[model samples]
Target: MRRRLAALLCCLLCLTGCATLAPPYETPAPASSSHWPAGAAYPTLADNAGPLAMHLPLGQVFPDQRLQQLLSLAIANNRDLRQAVIAIEQSRAQFQIEGAALLPQVDAEAQGYRERRPADLSGTGQSRITSEYRAGLGVSAYELDLFGRIRSLRDQALQTYLATEEARRAVHIGLVAEVASAWLTLAADQEHLRLARETLTSQEASYRLIQSRYDAGISSALDLHQAQTSVDNARIDIARYSRLVAQDQNALTLLVGSAIPANLLPEGLQDIRIAISEPAIGLPSQVLLQRPDILQAEHQLRAAYANIGAARAAFFPSIHLLGSFGSASAELTDLFQAGSLAWSFTPQISVPIFDAQRNRLRLRVAETERDLLLARYDKAIQTAFREVADALAAFGTLDTQLQAQRSLVDATANSYNLSQARYQQGIDSYLNVLDSQRALYRAQQELISTELGRQLNRTSLYRALGGGWYTSEPS
Candidate 1:
């Protein structure tokens, strides 16, 4: 009889987790075009058509030694990224915790007891004493996943863990982009500061020339004051750009999570202008799927599906088994001796006969959550499409704009020189020189801005295409 019962238990164990009621999951179709949008906004690229960002790591993207070193520091020290990594570990442990539920939980225990009773309370009508001791090995209430409830839970945890890992990758990509962006901004601002100081020095010299002319009656008070005003304006700008450069440095330091070395600070944006090269963008919308944010969304949707399976199993009966084997004796010395063997086996089946529709509601909640995640997954893809398109639009026209701006600076510089020579030859008023100088300075500033814009847009395109995503997953 015992052998037959043991065989029956073995068959039950084999039959456990044989079924799942969860609906099959299907990846949602993206509501976007197969190819990049084409128009004046999305111009053709002369770049050699090749791979996307998967082959473009950070080392290739920035190429600047100082920027590369800064990126390394940020990756090693950024608190936000550290937290994301810690969250991946947390999720991994949670997955393992849930997985352990699929097996029996064995426990070992030991106990001792002593008691004395008065004669009035004793059935023997005399004072009595008793001593008892017990020791055992047991399987706690281990749920048999006949309907895949435990398996579904484990699946849900695994997917969630994977999603967390993807989230960490997303953080990493964003951090690299942010550090590079900040560094570029600092370089641009520093260039602006240097230009302002140079302008101040030139204007100071011009002021002295105008003062000497006024003393000799060769210039009017109006001319003298105007020259002084130009000098003051340069001074104001120098101060303003100085403040901006300092602020940019502070922001970059914050992103790096440590003080940046003096040598690593960018001297000018020119050095980094060609550092970030745009890829050929030869791939299709499928490339967007590789983005960490989108992958994280897909994993979360999968976890929601697993949750639905677990909820569905809640409507069926669940079986829990508790068993133990041990030896107990009244004497401590004989606790583990023969003839003192103790054992027990309990099989519990909890049928969900009725619970005021609790199980139905739980299943509904799980299904609704799945629907929510599916919608999110679809939105993530659409958002990615828009970001890439916007970056492309800016990238398409930025080079033309930069060339036009450089031409403008050259034209203004020629005009400024001619105006200054005419004023010295007494053929034109000082106003013309002042106006030309102002125009030339503004044009130069615009050229710097345009160059900076081109570089930043290149970085944006790289990020939108999910650069810096390749990394080691948790082992």
Candidate 2:
């Protein structure tokens, strides 16, 4: 008994001694900031003139509660996001399962049998063998993680789970941006439709007036024809805007995961308000941490770090402990007898004696993979910064454009009014009036389009800033 005890102790010490020699795990150096790609010459986010603080409730008033509700529903029920949620759950379960490997497992076994013995069976007598049920708890092949292999694997699984969560967040950020962009388009299209309707109304009135003047021989046929053409063109625009609205509606329906009722559309342009309030763009360095894609990339890099450690460990010897305990007996009643006890333990060590350089190749591969992930992470950060800069630059330039456009529209409208008055008094030819009106209409449309673009760009900036989406999902 002492000898057996001494043997078991020696086996344990052998494994423990090997455990002391575990390969040193070193985390790869973080991606260098110098490696981050250089973006364009756009102004730094800190120097940008947008709002310096990220405020909730952007204060761009959309009077349409229905649009807000639709946005909420889409966030909740969107198919892509739902699928992402399922993926997170799956990853969570997998991590948990892999983690369970670090702990021992216990189980119970039971058996009952009845057999008729034939002559010469069991050394001879013809007898009936019956066995009552017996049950006992057993442990089989429980491997002790003496070298932290299972722990490292569990850590890898954990990092993967976190990466999946970030992936889901990234999806959410994308989905919200999509919804906001679609909503902005819908709003702008509605505005365009409104302008088209107004223009059509004015053109129809002008056409009627010109037709009366022509019949009364007060104006030339050319004037009548020009007025009719304006009306026809206005009608064409109305149809085009109508089609655009329909398309936007379809897109919103798909985004929201359900059809939007007709009554749900905003009644007028005033009812559709875009939040023009700018959020604060923090320092460029902070922006790197804010972007979900960057965060996801970082998590991937971390997982790769853990993988390198695991691979390096493989270069050292591996120890496995395999053992099982059970009870058996030739006779039914003797199944639980002391003599029935059986157990075996095997302590194994497999050193890399020869593998034709396969182990070295694997280690090299792991190291290379780590480097690739590091590069990718660095690139992601740089890209994220560039997007923020781009969005901010567009926002700045578009703001100036929209302001200038509004001024031009005002000037054109005034000029058109003066020309129309002068022509009615016979001080200017009808051609001058037509020219003024056309310019005014074009300017008006352009201004509206530009304003809409400004809002859209603002939305893009918010997305690039990572907005409030980082905490959108629970940890």
Candidate 3:
């Protein structure tokens, strides 16, 4: 019995040299251009000599101390990120379960039996009873995997687990960019609020001056009412910007997964800092593959290939081995005696003769899934390529646009000053002063908006470039 059990164990340990029926895996056909889009709109990158794109550290991209702290809090506390991590662990456990199918499950078992028979039935002319006891280790229905069916399933599970890991990384990268964008938006709103309040104060002073002039018969009621209208517009904007700032704060808090401390909040757009680290723009294939989403799709495609292997394997025979070795005796005390040894071995082979085309249908399903995944993988690459191209186009022109907006603001401010002085010297109508003030206010708001767009573009570029971040505060 011991020798038989040893042989069975040896058999399990010798399961090798098997190959799967799955087709060889190759990267699906390219769905997009091999190169990034380049024209007058796209930035001409001088630093394209670097390595293929990778996620720069969050700290290296967003250098603000306050922003870094916020990113850390979001990573640690965000529920979405937590869910992503849990998903990875779940997939890993499933892979482990699939891997265990190829191994024998050996365990101990014991049984007792008692029976009675009439004398006539026993042919002994007297009633008699029989008793037996047995105990030993046994193995039940362990598949030999001669065709790699179980192995293929195990590989499928492993690839799925890896895909889950890539998914988590994708979420992590997105969270960092989201936090940065939210912080910048909040700062921009705060700046807008500050400008509105200052404009309100200036308008109130102008209204009072116009009121004095009207009482002295030097300014018309039209002038006084126009000054009042300007003050009212500033007040309206103050209220609007105040509401926006509050909403921005709420949004940031949700992303952080907790209430924000006052110290970690941004003061204004001017206080936020970002560094554009231009990664080496390379072939579209190299840049797109570095994105976690793209990598995740690729893994999924590979997992589909494994599923096909498993399905094909199902068409072949499957072998299962079962065995038990132990001692048996009519008397309980004799169960383990030297002369009471007993053993049994059973092997099962299942060859699919006819199953209403079930196996063929399954194989078809697996092939279809593989094809679908391949398409999705190709689409993912194409999408990422387009995103990077769009970001590059925006980056090239934003600096010039921002500079022009600044110049417009400066010119408007100078015109407002000149018009105001002329009205006070009684050489110009108050309408000119009002028009200059309105232009100045509009230009200032546009400046703030334009600057915000420039900063937002930087954040978008960081996301498009495919980077990662530490879960903890950057030191």
Candidate 4:
């Protein structure tokens, strides 16, 4: 009888291994345009065709050795990214735990017990003592998974683990982008501070000349006050930019997760040049699918789909096997004696008959969750598409804007110089010199701001294109 039962159990296990109730998985079609939007804002195929044939690492993307080192440090030490990596490990463990249910769990067991029985209960006039000893290997309540309930649950966990891994990659990518931006910002602010100091020195010298003229009765009080106003404005800007530079340093330190070395810190814009090599954008819709966040969303959708499978399997009969092969003896000395060999097998079948609509409700919930994640996946792709498009638009025009700003600064500087010369020769009023100086200062500030924008836009474009996360491979 036992031999027949063992053969039957083996056959059932073999059959169960081939069953899966989970719906077939197919990647959902993207709900967006196939190609990038056409305009001057986007790079022409010829322009992007060369050099951009592959994805580049962050080190290659930034080109600046200092920025690359900082990126490495941030990836290693950033707390948020560290937590994300830890989360992936946690998810992996959970997946292992869930997947283990698909197989039988065998455990070795040994037990000894002594019991004293009351006289009446033992059916004797005196109390009696009994001892029992047993040792064996046994399989506990291991689900057979005949309907693939356990398999589906394991699949869901596996997908969830994969999603977590993608999420970690996403965090890593964002951390690199943030660290680069912070370094760039510090560089820009330092440049601004230096410019402000230089302007202040020049304005102070003009103020001293005006004061001397006023004392000699050659210049009016209005002229002296106006010159002092320029000096005061420069001083105010110096103080403001000084604070900004310090704040930028602090921000970079926070992103770096430790005090940065003075040498690695950006001293000025010129010190931190971000020369990112362009990456292949491929088809716009296809590129979105490659983005970490979008991939994570799709993994979540797949998990939900697996959940629906598990829920559907819940409506079928579940088979569980609990068996043991061991020896039992009343005396410890005979626990493993020749006559003590014994074994038992027990299989249980549970069929859901009436669960008050609970199973149906669970299936409904799982289906709804799948639908929700499907929508989220589509939205993630859309959001990624928009970010790339916006970055491209900014990238295409920022160079032109920077060029115009530089030309304006040059023209304003020349105008200021000519106006100051005219005033010294009494060819123009002091008011004209003051006006020109103000215009020159404003134009210089704008030029610095535009230059910062141009550099920042480059970083944005690199990030939007999902560069720095992986090495380029032949597509």
Clashing residue pairs in candidate 4 are: none
For every candidate in turn, the CA RMSD to the true structure comes to: 3.4, 5.4, 3.6, 2.4
What tens-digit string does per-residue lDDT give for candidate 2 at 171-194?
877776787778778877888888
Q: What is the lDDT of candidate 4?
A: 0.83
Misplaced by over 4 Å in model 3 are 1-17, 46-55, 117-126, 277-279, 468-475
Task: State residue 81's C-alpha deviation in candidate 2, in Å.
Answer: 0.5
The digit string of per-residue lDDT tens for model 1 on 1-475 reads 7799799789888877586677798888776666777799776743322444344556776888888899999999999999999999999999999999989998998899989999999899999988899898889999988889988999999999999999998898889888888888889888889899999999999999999999999999999999998999999998999999999999988889998999999999776754544445644454688888999999999999999999999988988999888988899999978899988889999998879999899999999999899889988888998988898899888988988998899999999999999999999999999999999999999888888888888777777877742222222
Instruction: Please report the candidate that would top TM-score against the real structure.
Output: 4
After aligning candidate 1 to the native by TM-score, how far in Å is the CA of 243 from where it should be? 1.1
The C-alpha lDDT values of all candidates are 0.85, 0.70, 0.85, 0.83
Candidate 2 vs candidate 4: which has greater TM-score?
4
Pairs with steric clashes in candidate 2: 52-280, 53-280, 60-275
Candidate rank order under lDDT: 1, 3, 4, 2
Tens-digit lDDT track of model 3 for 204-263: 999998999999999998999989999999999999999999999999999999999999
Error of 2 at 172 (Å): 1.6
Model 2's alpha-carbon lDDT is: 0.70
Task: Please provide the root mean square deviation of candidate 3 (C-alpha atoms, Å).
Answer: 3.6
Q: How many clashing residue pairs are found in candidate 3?
A: 1
Q: Which clashing pairs does model 3 show?
A: 55-467
Give the TM-score of each candidate: 0.94, 0.81, 0.93, 0.94
